[model samples]
Target: MSGNTARRPLRADALRNYERILAAAQGAFAAHGASASLEEIARQAGVGSATLHRHFPSRRSLLEVVFHDRVEALCAKAQERAEENEPGAALFSWLGDLNAYAAASRGLVASLLHDGRDTDLLQQNDSCKTMITTAADELLRRARQAGAVRPGVHTEDLLTLVSAISLATEHPDDEQAGRLLDIAIHGIRLHQHQRAATNRETPARFSE
Candidate 1:
Protein backbone atom coordinates (compact mmCIF):
# COMPACT_ATOMS: atom_id res chain seq x y z
CA MET A 1 0.00 0.00 0.00
CA SER A 2 3.02 2.28 0.41
CA GLY A 3 6.00 1.48 -1.82
CA ASN A 4 6.13 1.23 -5.59
CA THR A 5 5.55 -2.51 -5.55
CA ALA A 6 4.88 -2.99 -9.22
CA ARG A 7 7.65 -0.82 -10.56
CA ARG A 8 10.73 -2.45 -11.98
CA PRO A 9 14.19 -1.91 -10.56
CA LEU A 10 15.89 1.20 -11.87
CA ARG A 11 19.59 1.92 -12.31
CA ALA A 12 21.04 4.14 -9.57
CA ASP A 13 21.27 7.14 -11.86
CA ALA A 14 17.79 6.54 -13.27
CA LEU A 15 16.35 6.35 -9.76
CA ARG A 16 18.01 9.63 -8.88
CA ASN A 17 16.54 11.24 -11.96
CA TYR A 18 13.12 9.86 -11.07
CA GLU A 19 13.32 11.21 -7.57
CA ARG A 20 14.41 14.61 -8.88
CA ILE A 21 11.47 14.70 -11.27
CA LEU A 22 9.04 13.85 -8.50
CA ALA A 23 10.50 16.46 -6.17
CA ALA A 24 10.43 19.09 -8.88
CA ALA A 25 6.88 18.18 -9.89
CA GLN A 26 5.73 18.47 -6.30
CA GLY A 27 7.06 22.04 -6.02
CA ALA A 28 5.72 23.07 -9.42
CA PHE A 29 2.29 21.60 -8.74
CA ALA A 30 2.13 23.23 -5.32
CA ALA A 31 2.83 26.62 -6.88
CA HIS A 32 1.07 26.32 -10.26
CA GLY A 33 -1.83 23.93 -9.65
CA ALA A 34 -2.50 20.64 -11.55
CA SER A 35 -2.28 22.31 -14.95
CA ALA A 36 1.36 23.29 -14.51
CA SER A 37 3.50 23.05 -17.63
CA LEU A 38 5.35 19.84 -18.43
CA GLU A 39 8.23 21.80 -19.96
CA GLU A 40 8.65 23.85 -16.82
CA ILE A 41 8.61 20.73 -14.67
CA ALA A 42 11.19 19.06 -16.89
CA ARG A 43 13.37 22.16 -16.75
CA GLN A 44 13.09 22.30 -12.97
CA ALA A 45 14.06 18.63 -12.74
CA GLY A 46 17.08 19.42 -14.90
CA VAL A 47 15.96 16.71 -17.31
CA GLY A 48 15.13 16.97 -20.97
CA SER A 49 11.45 16.77 -21.99
CA ALA A 50 12.15 13.38 -23.58
CA THR A 51 13.66 12.09 -20.34
CA LEU A 52 10.70 13.30 -18.29
CA HIS A 53 8.36 11.78 -20.84
CA ARG A 54 10.24 8.49 -20.83
CA HIS A 55 9.85 8.24 -17.07
CA PHE A 56 6.37 9.71 -16.43
CA PRO A 57 4.82 9.44 -19.92
CA SER A 58 2.03 11.90 -19.12
CA ARG A 59 1.00 14.65 -16.70
CA ARG A 60 -1.42 12.36 -14.89
CA SER A 61 1.32 9.77 -14.32
CA LEU A 62 3.54 12.32 -12.60
CA LEU A 63 0.64 13.68 -10.57
CA GLU A 64 -0.32 10.16 -9.50
CA VAL A 65 3.21 9.48 -8.23
CA VAL A 66 3.30 12.71 -6.22
CA PHE A 67 -0.14 12.09 -4.73
CA HIS A 68 0.63 8.45 -4.10
CA ASP A 69 3.75 9.39 -2.17
CA ARG A 70 1.70 11.70 0.05
CA VAL A 71 -0.83 8.98 0.70
CA GLU A 72 1.98 6.56 1.51
CA ALA A 73 3.42 9.00 4.05
CA LEU A 74 -0.02 9.53 5.60
CA CYS A 75 -0.55 5.78 5.80
CA ALA A 76 2.81 5.38 7.51
CA LYS A 77 1.78 7.96 10.10
CA ALA A 78 -1.49 6.11 10.66
CA GLN A 79 0.42 2.89 11.16
CA GLU A 80 2.61 4.60 13.73
CA ARG A 81 -0.45 5.91 15.59
CA ALA A 82 -1.92 2.42 15.65
CA GLU A 83 1.06 1.21 17.63
CA GLU A 84 0.60 3.88 20.34
CA ASN A 85 -1.30 2.94 23.53
CA GLU A 86 -3.68 5.92 23.46
CA PRO A 87 -6.42 5.04 21.00
CA GLY A 88 -8.32 8.32 21.20
CA ALA A 89 -5.24 10.46 21.07
CA ALA A 90 -3.78 8.45 18.23
CA LEU A 91 -6.93 8.76 16.13
CA PHE A 92 -7.21 12.48 16.76
CA SER A 93 -3.52 13.00 16.04
CA TRP A 94 -3.79 11.07 12.79
CA LEU A 95 -6.81 13.12 11.84
CA GLY A 96 -4.72 16.21 12.41
CA ASP A 97 -2.09 14.77 10.09
CA LEU A 98 -4.75 14.14 7.48
CA ASN A 99 -5.88 17.74 7.78
CA ALA A 100 -2.33 18.91 7.24
CA TYR A 101 -1.82 16.71 4.19
CA ALA A 102 -5.10 17.92 2.69
CA ALA A 103 -4.15 21.53 3.32
CA ALA A 104 -0.77 21.10 1.65
CA SER A 105 -2.13 19.37 -1.43
CA ARG A 106 -4.80 21.92 -2.27
CA GLY A 107 -3.90 21.86 -5.94
CA LEU A 108 -3.93 18.08 -6.46
CA VAL A 109 -7.56 17.48 -5.41
CA ALA A 110 -8.70 19.17 -8.59
CA SER A 111 -6.92 16.57 -10.75
CA LEU A 112 -8.61 13.66 -8.94
CA LEU A 113 -12.02 14.86 -10.16
CA HIS A 114 -13.91 15.88 -13.27
CA ASP A 115 -12.61 17.39 -16.57
CA GLY A 116 -8.90 16.81 -15.88
CA ARG A 117 -9.40 13.15 -15.01
CA ASP A 118 -7.39 10.15 -16.14
CA THR A 119 -7.87 6.43 -15.54
CA ASP A 120 -4.47 6.00 -13.90
CA LEU A 121 -5.10 8.99 -11.66
CA LEU A 122 -8.50 7.68 -10.60
CA GLN A 123 -7.12 4.22 -9.83
CA GLN A 124 -4.28 5.65 -7.79
CA ASN A 125 -6.78 7.85 -5.92
CA ASP A 126 -8.97 4.86 -5.19
CA SER A 127 -5.98 2.91 -3.87
CA CYS A 128 -5.03 5.74 -1.54
CA LYS A 129 -8.65 6.05 -0.37
CA THR A 130 -8.76 2.35 0.43
CA MET A 131 -5.51 2.52 2.44
CA ILE A 132 -6.82 5.50 4.41
CA THR A 133 -10.18 3.84 5.02
CA THR A 134 -8.56 0.67 6.32
CA ALA A 135 -6.27 2.60 8.66
CA ALA A 136 -9.06 4.86 9.96
CA ASP A 137 -11.43 1.93 10.46
CA GLU A 138 -8.87 0.14 12.64
CA LEU A 139 -8.24 3.27 14.75
CA LEU A 140 -11.95 4.01 15.08
CA ARG A 141 -12.70 0.46 16.11
CA ARG A 142 -9.99 0.61 18.74
CA ALA A 143 -11.32 3.91 20.08
CA ARG A 144 -14.83 2.56 20.25
CA GLN A 145 -13.58 -0.55 22.05
CA ALA A 146 -11.78 1.64 24.58
CA GLY A 147 -14.97 3.69 24.82
CA ALA A 148 -13.04 6.82 23.88
CA VAL A 149 -15.32 7.34 20.88
CA ARG A 150 -19.06 6.88 20.53
CA PRO A 151 -20.52 3.73 19.05
CA GLY A 152 -21.84 3.81 15.45
CA VAL A 153 -19.29 6.46 14.46
CA HIS A 154 -17.95 4.72 11.37
CA THR A 155 -14.75 5.46 9.45
CA GLU A 156 -16.61 7.35 6.75
CA ASP A 157 -18.14 9.78 9.24
CA LEU A 158 -14.75 10.70 10.70
CA LEU A 159 -13.19 11.02 7.25
CA THR A 160 -16.06 13.12 5.92
CA LEU A 161 -15.93 15.44 8.90
CA VAL A 162 -12.16 15.93 8.64
CA SER A 163 -12.28 16.23 4.86
CA ALA A 164 -14.92 18.92 5.16
CA ILE A 165 -12.81 20.81 7.66
CA SER A 166 -9.79 20.52 5.35
CA LEU A 167 -11.75 21.81 2.35
CA ALA A 168 -13.44 24.58 4.35
CA THR A 169 -10.09 25.95 5.47
CA GLU A 170 -8.11 25.35 2.29
CA HIS A 171 -6.64 28.83 2.33
CA PRO A 172 -6.70 29.29 6.11
CA ASP A 173 -4.12 28.54 8.81
CA ASP A 174 -3.52 25.30 10.74
CA GLU A 175 -5.10 26.82 13.85
CA GLN A 176 -8.45 27.07 12.09
CA ALA A 177 -8.14 23.45 10.90
CA GLY A 178 -7.17 22.32 14.41
CA ARG A 179 -10.04 24.19 16.08
CA LEU A 180 -12.56 22.52 13.78
CA LEU A 181 -11.04 19.07 14.39
CA ASP A 182 -11.09 19.73 18.14
CA ILE A 183 -14.79 20.45 17.94
CA ALA A 184 -15.47 17.28 15.94
CA ILE A 185 -13.30 15.11 18.18
CA HIS A 186 -14.97 16.52 21.29
CA GLY A 187 -18.41 15.60 19.95
CA ILE A 188 -17.34 11.98 19.32
CA ARG A 189 -15.24 11.32 22.46
CA LEU A 190 -16.79 9.63 25.48
CA HIS A 191 -15.89 10.34 29.09
CA GLN A 192 -14.48 7.67 31.41
CA HIS A 193 -17.68 7.03 33.38
CA GLN A 194 -19.76 7.27 30.25
CA ARG A 195 -17.49 4.71 28.65
CA ALA A 196 -17.93 2.32 31.56
CA ALA A 197 -21.72 2.65 31.54
CA THR A 198 -21.90 2.31 27.78
CA ASN A 199 -19.71 -0.78 27.99
CA ARG A 200 -22.06 -2.32 30.53
CA GLU A 201 -25.19 -1.50 28.55
CA THR A 202 -23.69 -2.56 25.23
CA PRO A 203 -21.37 -5.30 26.42
CA ALA A 204 -22.15 -7.54 23.47
CA ARG A 205 -21.40 -4.71 21.04
CA PHE A 206 -18.32 -2.98 22.46
CA SER A 207 -16.64 -5.08 25.13
CA GLU A 208 -15.32 -8.51 24.30
Candidate 2:
Protein backbone atom coordinates (compact mmCIF):
# COMPACT_ATOMS: atom_id res chain seq x y z
CA MET A 1 0.00 0.00 0.00
CA SER A 2 3.00 2.33 0.07
CA GLY A 3 3.20 4.97 -2.63
CA ASN A 4 6.57 3.85 -3.96
CA THR A 5 5.56 0.21 -4.25
CA ALA A 6 2.11 1.00 -5.50
CA ARG A 7 3.32 3.43 -8.12
CA ARG A 8 5.89 1.06 -9.58
CA PRO A 9 4.83 0.55 -13.15
CA LEU A 10 4.25 -3.01 -14.32
CA ARG A 11 2.09 -4.82 -16.80
CA ALA A 12 -1.27 -4.71 -15.07
CA ASP A 13 -2.87 -6.87 -17.73
CA ALA A 14 -0.23 -9.61 -17.49
CA LEU A 15 -0.66 -9.68 -13.76
CA ARG A 16 -4.37 -10.22 -14.25
CA ASN A 17 -3.62 -12.89 -16.85
CA TYR A 18 -1.30 -14.82 -14.55
CA GLU A 19 -3.85 -14.65 -11.77
CA ARG A 20 -6.51 -15.90 -14.12
CA ILE A 21 -4.31 -18.69 -15.38
CA LEU A 22 -3.50 -19.83 -11.87
CA ALA A 23 -7.14 -19.78 -10.84
CA ALA A 24 -8.14 -21.81 -13.85
CA ALA A 25 -5.23 -24.17 -13.42
CA GLN A 26 -6.10 -24.78 -9.77
CA GLY A 27 -9.65 -25.76 -10.66
CA ALA A 28 -8.57 -27.87 -13.63
CA PHE A 29 -5.97 -29.81 -11.69
CA ALA A 30 -8.31 -30.42 -8.79
CA ALA A 31 -11.23 -31.60 -10.92
CA HIS A 32 -9.04 -33.35 -13.38
CA GLY A 33 -5.53 -34.68 -12.88
CA ALA A 34 -1.96 -33.80 -13.78
CA SER A 35 -2.79 -34.54 -17.39
CA ALA A 36 -5.60 -32.01 -17.55
CA SER A 37 -5.63 -30.09 -20.79
CA LEU A 38 -3.81 -26.79 -20.94
CA GLU A 39 -6.24 -25.65 -23.59
CA GLU A 40 -9.08 -26.01 -21.16
CA ILE A 41 -7.18 -23.96 -18.62
CA ALA A 42 -6.72 -21.17 -21.12
CA ARG A 43 -10.33 -21.31 -22.15
CA GLN A 44 -11.48 -21.19 -18.58
CA ALA A 45 -9.18 -18.29 -17.78
CA GLY A 46 -10.62 -16.43 -20.77
CA VAL A 47 -7.17 -16.10 -22.19
CA GLY A 48 -5.57 -17.55 -25.25
CA SER A 49 -3.52 -20.72 -24.99
CA ALA A 50 -0.51 -18.59 -25.88
CA THR A 51 -1.06 -16.48 -22.80
CA LEU A 52 -1.23 -19.56 -20.60
CA HIS A 53 1.89 -20.94 -22.25
CA ARG A 54 3.60 -17.61 -21.80
CA HIS A 55 3.07 -17.72 -18.06
CA PHE A 56 3.55 -21.47 -17.75
CA PRO A 57 5.55 -23.04 -20.49
CA SER A 58 4.43 -26.53 -19.59
CA ARG A 59 2.21 -28.49 -17.23
CA ARG A 60 5.12 -28.83 -14.83
CA SER A 61 5.44 -25.06 -14.67
CA LEU A 62 1.81 -24.68 -13.73
CA LEU A 63 2.07 -27.46 -11.19
CA GLU A 64 5.18 -25.93 -9.65
CA VAL A 65 3.50 -22.61 -8.96
CA VAL A 66 0.45 -24.25 -7.45
CA PHE A 67 2.53 -26.57 -5.29
CA HIS A 68 4.89 -23.82 -4.21
CA ASP A 69 2.03 -21.56 -3.19
CA ARG A 70 0.55 -24.23 -0.90
CA VAL A 71 3.95 -25.15 0.54
CA GLU A 72 4.92 -21.56 1.26
CA ALA A 73 1.60 -21.04 3.01
CA LEU A 74 2.20 -24.19 5.07
CA CYS A 75 5.71 -23.09 6.02
CA ALA A 76 4.43 -19.72 7.22
CA LYS A 77 1.82 -21.49 9.31
CA ALA A 78 4.48 -23.76 10.80
CA GLN A 79 6.55 -20.78 11.89
CA GLU A 80 3.55 -19.02 13.36
CA ARG A 81 2.43 -22.15 15.18
CA ALA A 82 5.91 -22.73 16.61
CA GLU A 83 6.25 -19.22 17.96
CA GLU A 84 2.69 -18.96 19.26
CA ASN A 85 2.73 -22.15 21.35
CA GLU A 86 4.93 -24.54 23.27
CA PRO A 87 6.94 -27.01 21.21
CA GLY A 88 4.81 -30.08 21.79
CA ALA A 89 1.52 -28.26 21.40
CA ALA A 90 2.83 -26.37 18.41
CA LEU A 91 3.88 -29.57 16.74
CA PHE A 92 0.61 -31.29 17.51
CA SER A 93 -1.44 -28.41 16.17
CA TRP A 94 0.72 -28.07 13.11
CA LEU A 95 0.36 -31.76 12.46
CA GLY A 96 -3.40 -31.43 12.44
CA ASP A 97 -3.40 -28.35 10.22
CA LEU A 98 -0.88 -29.85 7.85
CA ASN A 99 -2.90 -33.04 7.74
CA ALA A 100 -5.93 -31.01 6.72
CA TYR A 101 -3.94 -29.09 4.11
CA ALA A 102 -2.50 -32.24 2.62
CA ALA A 103 -5.94 -33.73 2.56
CA ALA A 104 -7.31 -30.70 0.78
CA SER A 105 -4.52 -30.26 -1.74
CA ARG A 106 -3.62 -33.91 -2.12
CA GLY A 107 -5.35 -33.92 -5.46
CA LEU A 108 -3.34 -30.92 -6.65
CA VAL A 109 -0.01 -31.19 -4.87
CA ALA A 110 0.24 -34.92 -4.28
CA SER A 111 2.43 -35.43 -7.30
CA LEU A 112 4.61 -32.50 -6.26
CA LEU A 113 5.42 -34.04 -2.89
CA HIS A 114 8.50 -36.19 -2.17
CA ASP A 115 7.10 -39.60 -3.04
CA GLY A 116 9.10 -39.68 -6.29
CA ARG A 117 6.11 -38.24 -8.09
CA ASP A 118 6.59 -34.52 -8.60
CA THR A 119 10.09 -33.73 -9.77
CA ASP A 120 8.88 -30.16 -10.22
CA LEU A 121 9.03 -29.34 -6.50
CA LEU A 122 12.65 -30.39 -6.56
CA GLN A 123 13.43 -28.28 -9.58
CA GLN A 124 11.23 -25.20 -9.07
CA ASN A 125 11.43 -24.43 -5.37
CA ASP A 126 13.05 -25.34 -2.05
CA SER A 127 10.38 -23.77 0.15
CA CYS A 128 8.84 -27.01 1.38
CA LYS A 129 12.24 -28.56 2.08
CA THR A 130 13.31 -25.92 4.56
CA MET A 131 10.44 -25.09 6.92
CA ILE A 132 8.63 -28.43 7.10
CA THR A 133 11.75 -30.36 8.08
CA THR A 134 12.81 -27.67 10.52
CA ALA A 135 9.40 -27.66 12.12
CA ALA A 136 9.39 -31.43 12.32
CA ASP A 137 12.86 -31.47 13.83
CA GLU A 138 11.95 -28.95 16.48
CA LEU A 139 8.75 -30.78 17.35
CA LEU A 140 10.53 -34.10 17.44
CA ARG A 141 13.09 -32.70 19.83
CA ARG A 142 10.47 -31.31 22.15
CA ALA A 143 8.25 -34.41 21.95
CA ARG A 144 11.20 -36.65 22.70
CA GLN A 145 12.25 -34.54 25.66
CA ALA A 146 8.71 -34.41 27.05
CA GLY A 147 8.23 -38.15 26.62
CA ALA A 148 5.37 -37.50 24.21
CA VAL A 149 7.04 -39.13 21.24
CA ARG A 150 9.73 -41.78 21.46
CA PRO A 151 13.37 -41.08 20.90
CA GLY A 152 14.96 -42.00 17.54
CA VAL A 153 11.75 -41.22 15.66
CA HIS A 154 12.85 -40.14 12.20
CA THR A 155 11.40 -36.75 11.25
CA GLU A 156 11.32 -37.59 7.57
CA ASP A 157 9.56 -40.86 8.27
CA LEU A 158 6.96 -39.18 10.43
CA LEU A 159 6.28 -36.56 7.80
CA THR A 160 5.92 -39.24 5.15
CA LEU A 161 3.57 -41.21 7.33
CA VAL A 162 1.27 -38.24 7.81
CA SER A 163 1.44 -37.30 4.17
CA ALA A 164 0.64 -40.86 3.14
CA ILE A 165 -2.30 -40.98 5.49
CA SER A 166 -3.67 -37.85 3.86
CA LEU A 167 -2.91 -39.23 0.43
CA ALA A 168 -4.39 -42.67 1.00
CA THR A 169 -7.70 -41.34 2.32
CA GLU A 170 -8.80 -40.16 -1.13
CA HIS A 171 -11.33 -43.00 -1.09
CA PRO A 172 -13.00 -45.31 1.41
CA ASP A 173 -11.57 -46.00 4.87
CA ASP A 174 -10.92 -42.31 5.27
CA GLU A 175 -11.89 -42.50 8.90
CA GLN A 176 -9.05 -44.83 9.72
CA ALA A 177 -6.24 -42.41 8.88
CA GLY A 178 -6.94 -40.05 11.76
CA ARG A 179 -7.48 -42.91 14.19
CA LEU A 180 -4.39 -44.64 12.88
CA LEU A 181 -2.42 -41.44 13.26
CA ASP A 182 -3.53 -41.09 16.86
CA ILE A 183 -2.68 -44.69 17.56
CA ALA A 184 0.71 -44.28 15.96
CA ILE A 185 1.32 -41.16 17.99
CA HIS A 186 0.34 -43.00 21.14
CA GLY A 187 2.58 -45.92 20.35
CA ILE A 188 5.46 -43.61 19.55
CA ARG A 189 5.03 -41.76 22.85
CA LEU A 190 7.93 -42.31 25.15
CA HIS A 191 5.81 -43.37 28.13
CA GLN A 192 3.84 -45.89 26.10
CA HIS A 193 5.88 -49.01 25.80
CA GLN A 194 4.35 -51.57 23.54
CA ARG A 195 5.18 -54.85 25.16
CA ALA A 196 3.50 -56.74 22.36
CA ALA A 197 6.21 -58.24 20.20
CA THR A 198 3.57 -59.17 17.63
CA ASN A 199 2.91 -55.52 16.72
CA ARG A 200 4.00 -55.29 13.12
CA GLU A 201 3.07 -51.71 12.40
CA THR A 202 4.86 -50.01 9.56
CA PRO A 203 5.22 -46.27 9.36
CA ALA A 204 3.78 -44.51 6.34
CA ARG A 205 6.02 -43.12 3.59
CA PHE A 206 6.85 -39.40 4.00
CA SER A 207 9.17 -39.09 1.04
CA GLU A 208 8.46 -35.48 0.10
TM-score against truth, every candidate: 0.81, 0.62
Kindly report which residue pairs in candidate 1 clash with one another.
none
Q: What are the candidates' C-alpha RMSDs? A: 3.3, 8.1
Please write out the lDDT profile of model 1 over residues 135-182, one tens digit for every residue: 898888888777688776788999899889988987777799899989
Model 2: weakest 10-residue lDDT segment is 1-10
Per-model clash counts, in order, read: 0, 3
- Indicate the TM-score of model 2: 0.62
Report lDDT (CA) for all predictions: 0.81, 0.68
In model 2, how large is the Cα lDDT of residue 76?
74
Q: Give per-residue CA lDDT, model 2, range 1-208, as digits (tens).
A: 1111123443989888887887788778766756678999999999999899887788876777766666666767878887898766677777777776666666655444534566545554564566678877887777656646544577887788787788667764546667766766665655534323113442344112
The lDDT, on a scale of 0 to 1, for candidate 1 is: 0.81
